[model samples]
Target: LEDEAAYDRIASYSPYDNITAKPYPAILAMGGLSDPRVTYWEPAKWIARLRDVASAGPFLCRINMDAGHGGSSGRYKRLEEVALVQAFAIWAVERSAA
Candidate 1:
């Protein structure tokens, strides 16, 4: 299962539903705003869906920015992403402790 076929197979089955029913140890989602392969919107939608349906909605954090697919040329965008990652990491650690 590669490419679209794999995606189709996965989409046909709602695996996330099963996963969402359980308490998540943690959930972190990161995506590029200008990703050519998979747009940022997809993950944003996913995060919304997860939050709506997942029992552990509070554990999910999504980070995305308007930086073009890789290389990190946009200074402000990269800084924002870096900040988000740092914050999410700290949050995850603290949340797990509690």
Candidate 2:
């Protein structure tokens, strides 16, 4: 991504950079409080920006206090987090369709 054209192309993939007047679909942003790869605030910031810029939103932030980037350390807890994400996805899809 060092080359100017290559970097521009790569950067174009970010949703945050492409925000427009919405009726944009719901956004579920999940982040780990202790994530080493993606800090919790990154999602928070994106959601915040969406809320500010988009015309309408059901944008959500789910910050797992007991987990990191990979989610809960325990198997059951991890499953629960997965279920929550799946449920959210379904709900978002349903809302978008309605």
Top model by TM-score, which number?
Answer: 2
Query: Candidate 1, residues 1-98: lDDT per residue as tens digits?
Result: 56998877777785443445555555666666778876777666766677766666364535455454672556886786778778888987898788
Please, what are the lDDT tens digits per residue for candidate 2 over residues 1-98?
Answer: 46999878877897778777666678889999999999999999889889998955689998999778787878889889889989998988887788
- What is the TM-score of each predicted model, taking all chains together? 0.60, 0.82
The candidate scoring highest on lDDT is 2
lDDT of each: 0.65, 0.85
Residue 42 CA displacement from its true place in model 1, Å:
1.3
Clashing pairs in 2: none
Could you tell me which 10 consecutive residues in candidate 1 have the lowest summed lDDT? 57-66
lDDT of 1 at 75: 84
